[model samples]
Every structure is written in C-alpha cells, then in structure tokens.
Target: MQVTSHFYAQLTIAIIKGVASCLRLFHVLGLIILCSSLSLPLHAIEQSSNTQIKQVHLHDNQGKSINIGQLHVQADGQFTFELRDEVFSDHFLSMKEMKYIEGPELWCHIAYPYPLNRDFNADKAWLSHDLLFMYKKSNQFGAMMWQGVYYKFTKEDGRLIGYANGVDLSEIASAPEQIHTPFYDESYMEPHNAQERWLPTLTID
Candidate 1:
C-alpha cells in the first residue's frame, strides 16, 4: 500500500511539472507576440525596397562623362537623388547636374497656375551642368528638365511638386554585382527612328 501511494505521488508531481512547463512556454510565446506587435515599424513594409540604387550619368564639362545624382526612391514615395556636384554648373547633371524625374502623381506641385503670371510662375533655373535647362512650362506649367538633366520647380498652388522617380534596378539585386550590363543606351533611342519623331535619350558610355 505504501509503495502504491509513493508511485501515485510521484506521478502527480510529474503531471504538475509538465503543466507548469506548458504554462511557462505559453507565457513566453504571448510576450513575444506582444513585443512584436508594439515594435513594428510604420514604414517597415514601405521601406523594404528603399535601399535600391540605380545607375545615373550625365555629360559633364570638358565634354567628359560624369555621374551626378545617385537616384533612389523612398518609403514615403519620393525621390532622393544624391548629386556629386555641390554647385549648379554648366554641364554634368548625372555627375552633380540636375536630374529628370517621372513618377506617379509627381508633376503637380512643380506646375504653375495655367494663367502663369510671374507671381504664379516659379523661378526658372538653368543647370549649367550637363547643359540641362529647367523651365516651368507656362502652358502646362510643370517643370521640364531639358538638355538631359532632371530638375524641378515649385509653384505652391500646384498639386504635384516634381516628377516621381522610378525604381532602382540595383534594388532588385541580392548580392554585390560583379558583371555589370553595359550602359549602352542606343536601343533606348532606336525605336524613335521615324523621321522628325523625337528619339529616346541614348548614352554613349
């Protein structure tokens, strides 16, 4: 009878231990869930692709090639184009010259009022670097980056501030790239072969 009681007691103790272990496990899992829920970043999903970088180059002064803006998109859906040139110059937008941007709903803020009086029109900027000219289109009143550089002007009344930039090709990569695709852009222009039609911008480098 004593042996039987001892066995029963041991079995009860084992069961109690197992139950406590299970409860502790559940408690730990609950804490993890709560912390994760609180610590989630608002832009975690939005910025997942923000680290991408794209190739940008512009013709510079001395008739040389330059890489100006390191263009990339942001989590808040804006373009942050980093330029190598500090001061505005006569040529070399991709190498610190102006950058052209085209993105969704980005043309409004930079556009002036249709009647485009001087007060309504934004100041014009001529980017000497890369020979890119930025002028507010009076009729459309949106900023244009002529001479191949990307630039923007602002009219407080306008809805869009600038052309929204596109995604960076390098952002789609996983590891450092060893072999790079040549920057030959002739194909980007050949489609406009029809007479008088504007050709797509091509890069010689």
Candidate 2:
C-alpha cells in the first residue's frame, strides 16, 4: 500500500510538470508570432519612405529625343529633373538628323507643377509626350505638362514659342479651374524665335 501511494504521487507530479512545460512553450510561440505581425507594416513603411531614381527622355513634338535627363523622385511622389545644357538651338531644331553638339553646360532645374498626392498614380505615358514646359529662369518655377490643361503664359522676363501644341481649357469640361493661374495666359502662343526657344527633346542613353 505504501509503495502504491508513492507511485501515484510521482505520476501526478510528472503530469503537472508536463502540462506546465507545454503552456510555457505555447506562450513563447505566441510572443514570436505577435512580434512578426507587428514588423510587417514597419518594413513596408521603410520601403515606401525610400526615394527612387529614374532615367527619362524629354521628347520633342516630332518624336525625337534631344537630351537625357535624370528624374529624382521622392517617396511622397514629388519629382524633379536636372538639365545640364541649353536644349534649343537653330542648328538642332531645323535639322531632323544631327548629333546635338553645341550648348553651354549649365544646370536647369525642372520643378514639379503642383503638389502631387502621395498616392498619385505614376503614368509612364505622361512622362513620354510632346509636351510643353513653362518655366521662369530666375525664379526656377519650371513646370511641364501635356496638351490637356490650357496654360496662360505670362510674359515675365520670358518668352513662349508656339512650336509645341497648346490646350484650350475652355474646351474640356473636366479641366481644373486652377489653369487660370497667373503663370499662364489666354494669349495665343507666338511662333518660336531666335531669342525665345522651346524645350528640346531629351534622350536616355
């Protein structure tokens, strides 16, 4: 009888220890799973906060690339490009096939047109267009856009060449009212002249 009682006591203690060990193991696994789930969004946010760079070509109205520019895009969806040389020259624009040879090396900073939403959809087609750029050489308010919003070019120590096509905001029902900003005007775009030249094409190579 005494031996049987001792055996039962030992068996009960062993079962209790086994159950405690399993509970501890399950608690540790739960902590690990919780930590892993919490880190997923953190990893995604880190990747989204990183800036990206791309090589883009600025094409002219004739579908020819004049120069290559580097586009620096921020995580917030804003972007800018650096132009190293003067694009428009009488020799290059007149001839269809010629190596772009002559221009002074200077930095032309192209800024974004407006504040882009963080969730703005980056359309590759928008980047590749026979678009027109409106810029102020001194103020550095450079903006480029396609022929959808009518731009009213205000003559500030600047010139506009009608080489690129224009958009009439009145014709489009979906055109935003912001197109009437002082940066542009309703005046007809004058033809390209020697003094005021249009933005030349850009190539990626």
Candidate 3:
C-alpha cells in the first residue's frame, strides 16, 4: 500500500508538471503573436509617412502663376493637382498625348474620359469631350466642352464661358458640384486676349 501511494503521488506531480509546461509554451506563443500584430501597424504608418508629394509651379495664359502644393498620379494614369491655398483639392487631370505645338507659351492640356456626373449612367448617357487648358505665362485656365460651353479662370476671378445653358463653375461651392456640364451657364462669358506665346515643350528623355 505504501509503495502504491508513493507511485500515485509521483504520477500526480508528473501530470501537473506537464500541464505547467504546456501553459508556459502557450503563453510564449501568445506574446510572440501579440508583438507581431503590433509591429504591422507601425510599419504601415512608417510607410505612409514616407510617401512623397511632388510640387509644381504653373502659370496661366494671363501671366498669373500658381504654386501647386502636391501632385499625385493615380494607378489609372490620372493626375491630381492640389493647389497651395486649398482652392482645389484632388483636381483630376488626364494627359494621354503630348502634341507638339510650336509656340512660345507653356500650356498644359488635359482630356477627361470619366463622366463628371456620378449618377448619370455612362452606357446610355451622351458623352461630351471634356478638355481643359492651363497656360504657363498668362495664368489662365479654361475648359472647353463639345456641347459648346466652357469655363475660364484667371488669378482674380473665374467665369463660365460659352452658351448660357450650362452649369456655372463659379457657383460650385464643392468639388462634387463641379462635375456636371449641364449645370454651367453660357451667359457669363467675358472677353479676354488670348496669349500667342507658350512655354517650352516638355522633353522626356
């Protein structure tokens, strides 16, 4: 009986030691997993902080200059220009072709493929050719649509040009409101002298 009792006590100690070993192992694994999870967010934040934003200086046709704060290129090849004063944020621009124009002026031309109206169904909608122009020397910006309406912007003010039927870009308080062409007005057109000079052509080597 004594021997049997001693054997049982030894068995209990062994079982308890085994359970304690397993618990310690599990605790170590849990600590490792927690540490790994914490490091992932830190790494992501570091990467985000390292993202670079490019600066651009541009002038309009009227000799007005704007210092663009940041320029971002999206994955779809669209470019976003952010103005210094936050007058515009994430303004989308697309440049698919670099046409050689002989002039002493610097002009930035953009073609937009996406519809300005998000709710309009593109499949059944009548698409218009949305073209935007920015002059380097004159400090003028304009957009010409296929529907015969346009918007012109200068350093001091902006106006809706062309037919009186479209949306007024000047009245657009938000970026979302500037998307639809039908909302612009054509009666707001003002006469301005067009600059014949252009900046030097961009060369990609």
Each candidate structure's TM-score, on Cα atoms with residue i matched to residue i, is 0.28, 0.34, 0.34
Find the number of clashing residue pairs for candidate 1.
24
Model 1 per-residue lDDT tens digits across residues 1-205: 9999999999999999999999999999999998888767755755566655544443222334344455444445343345545423332322433233222111111111122112111232211111222322224332333312122323345221222112122222244342223221222322212222122121211
Give Cα distance to truth, residue 105, candidate 2, Å.
40
lDDT of model number 3: 0.39
Deviation in Å, model 3, residue 75 alpha carbon: 10
Model 3, range 16-47, lDDT digits (tens) per residue? 99999999999999999999999999998886
Question: Against the true structure, candidate 2 has what lDDT?
Answer: 0.41
Residue 10 local lDDT, model 1: 100
Once superposed on the true structure, which residue ranges of model 2 sit more than 4 Å away at CA?
51-167, 174-205
lDDT of 2 by residue, 1-205 (tens): 9999999999999999999999999999999999999999999979866866555454344554444445556777765555544553322212322223232221222233433332213532233221223322323232221222222222233322223324432233343366323233435443333233334433332
Q: Order of candidates by TM-score, top first?
A: 2, 3, 1
Which segments of model 1 are wrong by more than 4 Å?
Answer: 1-8, 27-55, 61-64, 74-77, 83-205
lDDT, model 3, position 153: 24
lDDT of each: 0.34, 0.41, 0.39
Q: Candidate 3, after superposition: displacement of residue 98 in Å?
A: 37
How many clashing residue pairs, candidate 3? 28
